[model samples]
Target: MSSLPDGVRSRTVSTDRLETHLLETGRADGDPVVFVHGNASSSRFYAELLADLPDRYRAIAPDLRGYGHSERRPIDATRGLRDFAEDIRALVAEIEIEQPALVGWSTGGGVVMRYAIEQPESVASLALLNPVSPHGYGGTRRDGTPCQPDYAGTGAGMANDDFIERLEAGDRRADSDASPRNVMRSFYLAPETELDPELEDAYVDALLNTETGDDYYPGDATASENWPGVAPGEGGTNNALSPKYLDLTGIVDIDPAVPILWIRGAEDRIISDTSFFDAGYLGKIGELPEWPGEDEYPPQPMVSQTRAVFEEYADAGGEYDELVVEGAGHSPHIEQHDEVLSALTAHLDDATTRIGNS
Candidate 1:
């Protein structure tokens, strides 16, 4: 593993399911806060954030299975976010963390949602940072309905071949459009914002740790009737995030609902209503050719779907707060650090109070 930023220490925790690699900071006996990272990223992404956490909080960021230095466990995509959630559950149990607050970013948000749904009593609070939709990533309508029963235009096939190749080869070239480094700069943060060389290098290193293959990064694919002509296959990272496998809309039914804090970047291109990563949107703009009209296959309303689910959760007695970081992109934590820190600290404080009362 590369050298972590100041105050962040690298460690491995052996859970019943898998041996997990993590970066941790703050006091070991302090309030537990677990940070879950998203796709193509690792715990290293939270190194600075964890290191800067309040002294009273024990912040830990684990590299989910097959990412970073963790064990390369085969992911069962058909299980949706269960594999990741179960690993988190086991890790928390093994570490004896009691009602830890979960902070999930992007895909990690989906995992934490699943964790909360499956084990609500174990969660103190939830902080979703530009999370994927409760209905999953793609192939869904604004009302959270699937564009097709098979969930085409999503999963592994949606991944760009050149991008995956660059990732697999650990390409660090900034010139190539497919390079992970370029992708991070273009989509992870505001395009005009310059990244510190050290931070940029570290971020690229973390991305390079992603395991790429039919059973990992992009996963597998199937034939499709959708414009993309590809559907979600049975297994892998992308498949795991497909709507066919992941759906947390049932969260409204959880008894004793967990408090939630939804933080998003106002300029996030990856999770927006017209996300550039979404095939339907790409097709609509003629980037993918042969778009099957908006009515038949509209772009997945990522943010709207999240709002609807959270609205339902609120109606069911769950409380939540949404904060939009203006001018930020997919990674508001990095782009708007001070704002994110303040929001997270406040949310954690509330979570502590809630847990105390409960």
Candidate 2:
């Protein structure tokens, strides 16, 4: 809606000749702290987060290629995680920020981390907010469906396993048999994880009226295959789609010097292990045995989908910190802004103090 606060410049950066939406805030001379939004969300996702911070620090948020103002360089191909990383990299270079600190939410976590890996000299640090665990993200259904589509017929009919999987995997038509009432009712789950129903209703109401989400729900087949941000086929993940443009498979273990700050919502199903962000499924990643004597492999759960960031972070032995926010879900910036700010402020204070030291 409104531009990302004041003082921060708003602009577009061209990558591979394609333009992407970018919002810059804070004093022009301040150090750059770039923001990357999650899938199906734009830079606007960080509007509240931007407002939560102090003016002394400059904050930047960019819309990943397809979701927002950013143009899709290759629309027909897959928009993988690597491509998302490239977009951020190109944007940073375009803006002329020297190794800006990268901060992302959800899928943004992967992008910044990969960027840090590839351009270690260009990174100051990494901050993940309810980040997507390397293992994978949890969803509404037991099968990892984030939301239920309308084609399932009715109340109970829509929750069917086959139906939900097909929908998340992008195989079914979202609107074919969907009912508006059903779409809305299914938004909530047991114990009410969110603080505001109207907040969700507003989004649902907006989507119902939007061009893609509402009446038409034209449908995207690959929505379920792991968000547009991370490329599945990269490390032989075997995800249905590969990143359409950039190749980002070989950059994970970034410079040992870069510090990592990770925050997880205590009840965040999307990141922790709520029915939406299963911690059990995540823990299982460590259960798998690794190749004998492979130093390249960081540890078990090479790519944790949830709590494992702490695992990976601790193993790395940097100035690592993790926070467990009580009663929060996927979007900590929105759901628990005040608490998240305090945590972030504490980290930044120490980080800024140690600037250029690392």
Candidate 3:
């Protein structure tokens, strides 16, 4: 466990799969709420959120395998997000948590969605904060069909080399735009939002803890005929998230659908309809070269795809709601803390009531 803020304590829980590191708040006897963090970030990212939760609920945020202080386990990208979902399952079992509300942010949201799909009976509720598309992050259309059979335009090939180098070196100097610190400042919040220097530094430290290699962060790549010239190479986090491997749109088929709360920053650029990071969008905007034109290589309709899936889920008798925080970016919980907290608290309460009634 690493040093964390007051009220947020760290501990290790041994699961059948691995020894997981977690940051926890609230009371041991309280209802459980598991928080799953996104890519490149550790459980520490949720420290403030955990501490702010009502005392009746125990807030626990665990560092996913291969990230933060967790064991550096081999990630089988072909399993899609199953590795992460199973890890969460094992953690919940080890902790003896029952019917815990699952909260996921960014890629973490994808993990929770898979969890709900695989173990619908175990989940009490779900909250997705700027989650990746249900069809996966990239290499797909609005309907989740791969643009190419090889799933190009995604995976490790899409990651910026300079950014990876800066992250690996723990580059704190904001001199270069590719520096992790600068990237976080630019993309994690709205431009006008003022960040506390110390908190920002802590968040950057969490990002630096990410393991970078062909087996971890960005994964590996292979040659392709697509405009990007590369495709997912079978393993690592990014590859696991490629449309070739990940897809949760079938969550609408979950026998007993879990209640869901979809909250996101309206101005989020990372997981938006035209994500700034998506190669197709970058190419269309002349930030990248040789886009195959919109018909052949359109920018991924991330938000639209997610909305469509949730719409189907709702039509299938699942309860779902949406909240868009104005002027926020990828991280609404941090940028618009009070509003997110209030909404989450209310959602959790409603979920608890619903579960109790059932």
Candidate 4:
């Protein structure tokens, strides 16, 4: 387990839905703020953020089922991210937290979006960091349209086998590109960011905590006649993120809008217009063979899709602010901590004020 900062405390909260581990700090009676982590990560990623939050705010980071010290519950991909969202609902309720400002990173962003959509009344505000598209991870066009009916070239099949092997073996060496440490350095943050050795080891430990199997991390996949030749299966994290089951655009229809803060690293490769993880992007870059022309299979315009949806969200009476941290990558909150924290705190304060006035 990674060492917790001085003010932060760790504990497990059991609810009917799932047993979740949480890292929490700040005053117990203060306004609540919850942090949701991305896939293959745990609450440990937010240890610093939780510790640094203003003393007037209660900051809590939960380990979603199957990640960190949380229970290894089977995810039902067919329900999209609802399982994860519901677990969060249970946790908040069990802890007596009401209408918290929800901060979600990557897949956790998708999960919270689903939660806000299902129960917008429960969310005071929403903060998304490098989130997956509202249309889900891949196999979708700019307008949230599926390129292939079967939604191929996504889900568990997209996960790297070598990386999975290394992760399963708990390989901590930064020797290979497939190693968790290397992946975090190469893809999780900007190339120029100098990572502290101890912090690197802590992050690697969090990465290795991911539960691996067909029912977990990458999930399962099946044959497809589409270009990439693989479609989403019925279980696991990746499949739940697949456009086949996840669509959060209904956020535009929430009657009473939840204020949203969208933050991302300007140099993010994982969730960008040309994401390194997307097969369509890879095919365009000539990394994958048998290039199907752009018209047939173009790279997903992920950032564009998000912008369009946010615009629609605005037009529908919701408000949002987008911040792009220059020298950061997927984890802007970590790469440029002070800057991101400044904006996040202001947002949370504003949201809390609005809640109080209402």
Candidate 5:
């Protein structure tokens, strides 16, 4: 494993739902800030961020179930990200973390949003970094409507088989388009952006730690009569992110509304309207055969959906800020470290002041 970032410590904590491994930094008495990593990643991704947080803030990043050093527990996709959210709840309780500021990246964004919804009083603030849509990842419209009744063309079936194979095999070499390293470089960051070699290796190492099977990474897929001939099955992480199961639009209605910071890379291909990872978008671009017309299967307007929902939240008396970082991709936190940190810390500070004043 790559060496941990300075001042970061790794430990495992037992929760009611699963055993969670986490990276932590800062003083025990400092204000709590929890960082949740995206899918196909682990807490290790946040080691440097945790190490660099302001001294007055205690930062914690946990490996969700089926990732990192955490227990390999089967995800219950039927509940969407609730299982993941509940795990965070359990961890917060176990660690006695008080009114934590929550930061979630990619799929982890869905996790924290769900957490805030289910446990509205728990979160002090939320930061979403290149997150999935408020409606879910794919198979949805700008108004949060499902394109197909069965939610076909979403979930584990959307995953590239070759990439899954390489991930399961732990192929760290960037020799193929499907290799985890190459995929990360291509889709996870700004095109041609080169990470520090050690951080690159550490990120890949975290990616490799993802548990793969019908019960994990790509999850399970069912045969479909729809364009993709596959639909989400009721198991695994990917399925949990499927719109058929996950609907985080209710976050707008959470009481004691938590302030939000939504950050996205301007060049992010994963969560954009024409997301490269979305099958519907692929069909529109003629990347998939037997193309379904745009009306029947349009590219999900993910960013628009998130914006619409946040607008509703704001109208309902909540507050949020959206940051679009240029020359970056899906993982802006890694690609534009200084800029992201500055925005994040300022947001946290504002939240801290709000809490103190209240």
Candidate 6:
């Protein structure tokens, strides 16, 4: 490799359905840990962090279809968090691992969030970094909104040039208006960050060889359900709180059986599955923490802020723990790699330890 550190030896586990990709290291005999990436990004986000982990962790970070190394198009048009879990299940079956720890970032958090709830057997425990969900999952978001796009109309393809142009334009506009600093809460925001290079290349390869490089999860279905009172934008606006409450409190009810460890950055902006904020969250990578004695100004909870929600969850003793990464923005793994790893290692060890004891 170039001046950048050498990444792990990875492979593509292709089933009859999809070819899963990963950046792996650690001993083969160690407990298998699967890493899931969030929306707008891929497993590539974890490259540096995984590369630096201890050798005892057999980590497998996969690019969810459409985001990373995996083929994107012709995917199940009905793809949802559960569909992602199915992929993880298939991967587990492929490796014949009895129990593997699950780790997800942002949208990937939503995936594992659903997985542990629906199929607890697959994940021994979870580590969610800067996770985004409209509902305060682990004190992330509590308004009971789901962030996704309104794929109701002409969602011809994930990579449809015209559609992509529109999407990119909207994203750029949102970024410009809300400010990249504000949107940093959504995912890793390196002043010079692009899609994971390897996964991006792999996607290009797949796009050239595959039939469809399109997104299966329609924006129409997922976007409308955002921060409780936030309405959909550019995509549409059906964001009235009452209907939103019914959709959240009644529709996709929260399950509390699964254990969660959430790492909140001092500055977190993006709320997952909830399109409450414009792509530009609070006009910064995320919201800054308001301390007790920092500003003479009185502190109040940030409106539609994910950090506030996550803190609330911790107070409720929701089977979860939260950490604040000082100086880290949206993607703590990038901002505080070592600290993030320490937190993850601790949680995973606890998970396998409990599993072994039980």
31: Cα error in model 6, Å:
1.0
Model 4: how far residue 13 lies from native, Å? 1.0
Per-residue lDDT of candidate 6, residues 188-212 (tens digit): 4433345455543432332222122
Q: Between candidates 2 and 3, which one is better according to lDDT? A: 3
Runs with alpha carbons beyond 4 Å of true place in candidate 5: none
In angstroms, the error of model 1 at 347 is: 0.3
| TM-score on alpha carbons, each prediction | 0.98, 0.64, 0.98, 0.99, 0.99, 0.64
Count of clashes in candidate 6: 36
Give the CA lDDT, 0 to 100, for residue 62 in model 6: 74
Model 6 misplaced stretches (Cα beyond 4 Å) = 1-4, 74-79, 134-187, 190-258, 272-276, 279-318
Local error of candidate 5 at residue 280 (angstroms): 1.3
Ranking by TM-score: 4, 5, 1, 3, 2, 6
What are the per-residue Cα lDDT tens digits for candidate 4 across 1-358?
8887789999998899888999999999999999999999999998988888999999999999999999999999999999999999999999999999999999999999999999999899999999999989987888888888899998998899999999899999989988999999999999998778898889899989999888899999999988888899999999999999999999888867999999999999999999999988999999888758788778988889988999999999999999999999999999999999999999999999998999
lDDT of 6: 0.51
Off by over 4 Å in 4: none
In candidate 3, the residue pairs with backbone N, CA or C atoms under 3 Å apart (3 or more residues apart, or in different chains) clash, namely none
After the best TM-score superposition of candidate 3, give how far the Cα of residue 113 lies from its true spot, in angstroms: 0.3
Model 3 earns a TM-score of 0.98
Clashing pairs in 5: none
- lDDT tens per residue, model 1, 194-277: 878988998999999999888888898989765679999877889999998998888887777988999999999998898998
**Each prediction's number of clashing residue pairs:** 0, 25, 0, 0, 0, 36
Whole-model lDDT per candidate: 0.90, 0.50, 0.89, 0.92, 0.91, 0.51
Which candidate has the top score in lDDT?
4
lDDT by residue for model 2 (1-358), tens: 3434454456777766458777766776777788886643567656666766777777788876555566644322233355667767877777778767778776677667667767787777778876654433321232222222311111111122443343335332335324332332332211344435444543333223222221111223222222111121212111201222223323335555566788766555434442321222322354323212222212222123334444454566655677767756566666677888888766766666677565
Better of 1 and 3 by lDDT: 1
